[model samples]
Target: MSGPPAAPVSGLRALPAPDDGWKMLLRKEVLRFWRVAFQTIAAPVLTAVLYLLIFGHVLEGRVQVYPGVGYVAFLVPGLVMMSVLQNAFANSASSLVQSKIMGNLVFQLLTPLSSWNWFVAYVGAAVARGLLVGLGVYLVTLLYAPPRAAAPLWVLAFALLGAGMMAVLGLLAGLWADKFDQMAMFQNFIVMPMTFLAGVFYSIHTLPGIWQALSHLNPFFYMIDGFRHGFFGASDVSPWLSLAVAGGSFALLSALALHLLKTGYKLRN
Candidate 1:
């Protein structure tokens, strides 16, 4: 006998139409934060503004960085980078953990989304959130002083690479963590410390020799330093070197993220 009646067609496609699934997932991830703009977007912008005002007011001439550049000018890139880094991590990590806790992760795992598709979707979404916040931070900071673009391409490069690296790392963290508290501990203890230490407020040159050397080891340093270079055309190190470090980290994190998703590590269990 013939099947009862043809079911209504739905937007979701099967494996053969992988693009549809990938796009849908990406859109879903974007809308997730867009829906909470006040919390996700507006709050970060406000925080960056406050930081620029407070720091710029207190340390205008007290802190001399890059010789001629004002302290306010130096602080903008760092705040933008900080916003990008934090939000990028938050987007993917929160999405995955929430899905897991709510028992909807199985639905995603059962989909036809390939590992690469998952990577692109989650990371793409995270990167979008990051760039959005970074741009917002930059614009907000500009109200205090002009945003001179010394090397626009380099600025774009760092923003994209830095955001992508964190996005992949977030995916990896999401794969490893079983609960929200565990992710919070990771963010608070590890991510926050690393970002803050990445030269958000002052030049690494101001630090003691040993601390300066230690800063060199932080990938976040490369991100902020390189981005600042895009603004002032100077940084603690060569922009090319920063590009290499950030680019390498992005590739490595992408590999790790894809591997976890492919193997269903901690996710399937």
Candidate 2:
């Protein structure tokens, strides 16, 4: 043999392949929303502002859900949380459904990334969008009627839990939906009705006994109610109970989403 196999190049030694698919996915997801900031973030914030102006003006002094708390003030946190939950879910669900429909998702499937990587990237993007939207709503609302935070931690806890729950649900919806119509059905019929009936603009205590019982069955109620507790230090239910409900719902949805991802339900199938 003339010589040992050529030595590795001096300045270009063999290197291991990089595992950066997760990074790429995350960057793409983030940039996807960032590039259209107005649509991803601003429009939602504006919609929230409109809700505040319209609702606050109309119901300002007429309604007082919590003792000594202005109606507008009482409404702000709930609205902020509501905006967060919806946008978070929308971000992931729309992205996944669009990618699948457009046949672009195949590129991702070709990567070496694991299913866990896919789950993390999508859910992370959704949570980021949700938090940003929630913060946007909060800052904008400060101009109209500032909210009080008796238990700031409780507020954050519920916000994070709600966002996490919705993000996972979005992922599941995206994976389960074969078309945009199905995703739309989920949002319009289920998410929309639940958010509206969750008492974001009012208190459940004012509802009829049967309605109150029904509201308790909605997990969204726990999220909004628990978040409200952070502001007013009071709620229709104990914050602990709210936390339990929100946390449990989040766990359930997350498990479902992860399962769908692992099984490649509508994705690879």
Candidate 3:
């Protein structure tokens, strides 16, 4: 009587909408790193603490980057920001490359998710991992020296911008790379060098004029400098300038990453 029982609904199911699709992918990515908390989260925190102990021991009372700020205190913020940047990049890049190598990336490709969905899910996961590692390092380093936040808003702003920038950069690296070795090269030759040269352990003001000029060229320098500014209310450059450079760099990288994803550059293959 009711049209033969509504034709016995089809066996096939509809694909998830963009909103729901991204949330599921994001949950999967978060769980991927959460399942290995020791390696993904704890390991980085330990490394930052080691850096603090070694550098803070040797440099404390010997050098002070800003007036009235101890070397250890100054070092804490740098370590936190460094951990944030590195872990963010590692999360997205490693996940993508590993999935590609394991032949599991095709599962993601088969989803009805759009490029925007992929970007938000992957970058969101990276940001989560990055902030978590940063917080862990900050809390642990407090045992050694507590860095005060003179401008808490600036600190939060730079931290978010820096994490977002590195996450997008990692997405680009993942897309361009085909194997682990290539990924290693990108990390070692590019990311590590930039972070180290970005005035993490020392201030650029101590460098020669030429070197200081070079330091200004590094975007990582702006990130760390701006973050350090939040603690001491002083920086090599204006915090607003750092905000502009960091914000602009993040935008450019995000646009490139989105373009690659939309075009299926290396992902479809």
Candidate 4:
């Protein structure tokens, strides 16, 4: 009472409370993968390199998909996109499903974190991982077959959009899956098939007319095709169409993921 309560004496000045919940979640997701760099980062890079070696040697001079481009050169962009897509999908899907199974997801809900924050955090982390893996594959592949870019901007755009699209799809897969088995089923049955069929190893133009049309129906094809165009300046479909498909797919999946989060589809109750 002597001096107006002496300004609330304390041992140390109180630190400002953290307000950016999304940033914390994003950081956590990033660190989660970074902590296991050997598994999450190095393993994929190694797998990609192996693909390059095995496929490059086998198809180097045999397959001439792009006009003047060697098969190995054509393969590099596809490998890069494949790594980006798979890793991006895996990052968000595994994180969410694992959190749900381990019963720690409820803790996140209890925080002031909003659904939008959740979306940003999960998708952003997935994109980061996907891009890193893609970059690793690209850099490593250059050693064996150095492919020059015709349109680097298109390469970057398709890479980002493709990764983002897969990330959003992963969010949906995570919410719908209750167990690890279901997640595995989703990956093996849906993701793996689509990716492999998306023309990672060959071009759609080499297929029959019916097959070529069907291949165009697969959104992953556009991503890979568009990405290849960036390198060779040619593709099965127009670059603009590829951009539209990839961009549109991302928007649609993002909306669905957001809806799931807002309604607490699987996370709550």
What lDDT does each candidate get?
0.89, 0.88, 0.91, 0.89
Clash pairs of candidate 3? Answer: none
Q: After superposition, how far is residue 115 of candidate 4 from its true place, in Å?
A: 1.0
Kindly list the per-residue Cα lDDT of model 1 for residues 1-269, writing each as its tens digit.
78799865232222343447889999999999999999999999999899999999999988878878989988999999999999999999999988989999879877877777788899999999999999888887778888689999999999999999998889888888889999998899989999999999988988999999999999999999999999999999999999999999999888877767666677766
Q: Give Cα distance to truth, residue 211, candidate 1, Å.
A: 0.5
How should the candidates be ordered by lDDT, best one leading?
3, 4, 1, 2
TM-score to true structure, per model: 0.93, 0.91, 0.93, 0.92
Which regions of candidate 2 fall more than 4 Å away from where they truly are? 1-18
Candidate 3 regions with alpha-carbon error over 4 angstroms: 1-19
Please count the clashing residue pairs in each candidate, in the order shown.
Answer: 0, 0, 0, 0
Instruction: Give lDDT tens digits, candidate 3, residues 23-83.
Output: 9999999999999999999999999999999988888999977888999999999999999
Worst 10 residues of 1 by lDDT: 9-18
Q: Write the per-residue lDDT of candidate 4 for residues 163-206, one digit (tens) a residue.
A: 99999999899999998899999999999899989999999888
User: Hey, what RMSD does candidate 4 come out at?
Assistant: 7.6
Report the poorest 10 consecutive residues by lDDT, candidate 4. 8-17
For residues 40-146, what per-residue lDDT tens digits would candidate 2 score against the true structure? 99999999999889998999999988789998898899899999999999999999999988999878776766667887789898989999999999998999886
Name the lDDT of candidate 3.
0.91
